[model samples]
Target: MLWLYLHFPHLLLDHIRRTREETGALVIVEGSGQKVIQACPEARDQGVHGGMRLKTAISLVPELGTVRADQQQEARILEDQARWLYRYAAHIVLVPPDGLMAEIGSLQRLYGGLPAAWQTVEQALDERQLIAWPGLGHTPLAARLIARAGKGECTDDKGHIQRTLGQMPLLAAEFDARTCTRLQRLGLNTLGEVFALPAAELARRLSPETLARVQKIQGTRPDPQAPWQPPHHFRQQADFVQEIEQSQGLLFPLQRILAELEEDLCWRQQETDSLLLVLQHRHEEPSRLRIRTSGPEHRAEAFLNLVRLRFEQHPLRAPVMSLQLSVKRFLGREADTGQDLLGESQDLNEAWHTLMSRLQARLGDQALQQLSPQADHRPERAWTASGVQRNNRPAATMNDQLPRRPLWLLQGPQPLTEAPTAWFAGPERISGGWWDGQRVHRDYYIAQLHNGQLAWVFRDVRDGWFVHGWFG
Candidate 1:
């Protein structure tokens, strides 16, 4: 079986740096915060290197940004990278903290060759701004060792792989310090020298566990790796080293995560109408915000715009420590209705939804409403204001069969001072409201006022005349 392994030297550092616009020196310190485990180019440009003491690094670059190294964070980011790689290769085995092993032998024909498949993964990492070293081998362990050493290549030749593997020193073979020292003292410096010894002699010289590791790397023993499958839903979070005091600061981090969501949605050929964003605070309860769109949407720019609006409407109550974005429910993507099948023109509904989503984000959802018809026949009582309901099909109508009504309806009845000169329509009766105790009993008419204005007048049972509305 052919295997491909990708090694990320500074996965966490790359992830954190991409979240902001600043180019200041940044370093990932050891868990204990005493030493630097990873440093960015800017930090290295200022003489800050990995394995340097944290105090020295800070001294070199006084404005250096420091993030404490974390195993869980690195593992999570590694899985995220695997999720993206899964699009190209199906059989993926995640190597925790910063590596991925993909069995690409089966894809030899799918991508034209193993080198082409390797190139696809390389391009994907480049597009994501991640630093990766790729290695190819017949065994998982061999690929991992070569990748870590930055000596990886695309050749599948057994001789080439063996010659490369033969040159790896005992230290790079993943042996314990004692074993490497013992081998070095015995003048066995490289794996090739160690392999030159007889099987029985090598087994007697090395421990059983070390012997097993060597056999696995040589492909004489099985190295079973469970394949990773992606989740049905999408979720990602960004933890910050520094607490963000302003609500706007959260946008930079959210931008990267939302972009991931967009990519995932596009890959699935589905869209989401809602997203849940939870902002963690140091001392206050976590603030949860649900961002909704007028319709199913997969574009990152649209999601970011809506989130920006939500931030403007709701300010941060406390300093944010982390940001979590999740989407559990996804809707099937609808066909672009406003476009031709040939794909020359674009969809109009897409533009409409963009506008509605932005407007609803700026104003509260409840602030925007739609007018719907009520059961009452009274002009004022015949319609009601309700929340806007967006859908593809037309709205079901209940008042379409009702008598002709003016486009403009008056709010209250005004007393008429003079009688009408002529009448065009009828005394359309609308006299029922006793159910809710607001009873109405009046005779309505359409007439022209003495001032030459078309009006809707009504006289109550008590003989009081009032102009209820005007026809425009």
Candidate 2:
């Protein structure tokens, strides 16, 4: 299998700065035991580094701005990119905040050749203003190392992978400075020298983990990767020659894209569950627009209508050059109820689409959200807001818990002056996320409050009482 590897050294901060259009100002996140989580290139240019003291970063940049790192936001962006890449290949593996590795061996035939496949991947990234150094090899680890080391076009044709990898400094594999220094001391500086050694001898000399790392890079061991799934059949596109400045200019292009998508869906014998619309601009980052039908739908007019509703309520920040519409998520084929005199299904779908489209055209993409259940049994952590196009359902465990959940839960738990509950149903306690050490052990309860409202409450063993949630 051909493994495609990517690495982004400053992915989190780069993504945050880009998406937020935050330039010149530096951002520092003091997360998980007050460690600096990310820093922008501009900040780095001024001598700020990840894990640097936030106070020191500010001292260096002076104008540094900061926000708590939102790993969820970064993860969502990665998920979207994975979905887009899925168009060109079957298996995509997420390497988290900064990387992705994909299996594209089977796609070589479909895209013509390895080079062409790389171009397709490049184009997808180009459309998103994302830069990736891509490398192909037999092992995921080898591909990742090559990509990180800037060997964009490297291939493992004649052990060139092993050779190229050998030439690379040990640090290229993300090994710690101590390990690299240790290897340098033994004249095993290059990965090739390490690879050339007898496995048992190397294991004896350094550590078994050292041998395992070499084995992974050499493809002697299986690298388990979590695969990404692409959405089912759907398509949408926008054509524009003249730049559209005003918000309303988006409508015609969106309608055109929806029309084409409708026709495409009809031909494919499919319906869409979630539609993702990307508005590519001439001078700025693309605006992401998305819409999810209440259920599976194939009616072109209805799809366009929902998007129109979203757009009409939301306005634009930049002029659109062209639009690309695609199904980010979907369900299987379904029978289309053509036209009816009652028009109940048709009218509702079309009306809903139109309303959503107008809202999206006017308000921008972040205006609308759908709710999803979360995995934690704690009612305060029971649900999350999701974008309509990416309607992620909650995990199975989320619904099976005995915790009486609230119909309405505050964004954060409300503190109570006194403790009311003596017995806890779930002294079912949790602790130790404390490596970053923001540990808490709460005695959670499903209790009846004085006002007759069923509340999900918790008492931190150290702190006092906090009303965590409510069950109406």
**TM-score of every prediction relative to native:** 0.79, 0.52
The Cα local distance difference test for each model comes to: 0.87, 0.68
29-129 per-residue lDDT for model 2 (tens digits): 75552656666667778888788877777778777767565576567556656655666677888888778888988888888888888888888677555
Which pairs in model 1 have colliding backbones? none
After superposition of all CA atoms, the RMSD between model 2 and the true structure is: 20.6
Candidate 1 lDDT, tens digit per residue, 43-93?
999999999999999989999999998898888889888889889989999
The runs of at least 3 residues in candidate 1 whose Cα sits more than 4 Å from the true structure, single-residue gaps closed, are 181-187, 239-241, 337-346, 371-387, 392-472
Please give the distance, in angstroms, between residue 100's alpha carbon in candidate 2 and its true position after superposition. Answer: 0.8
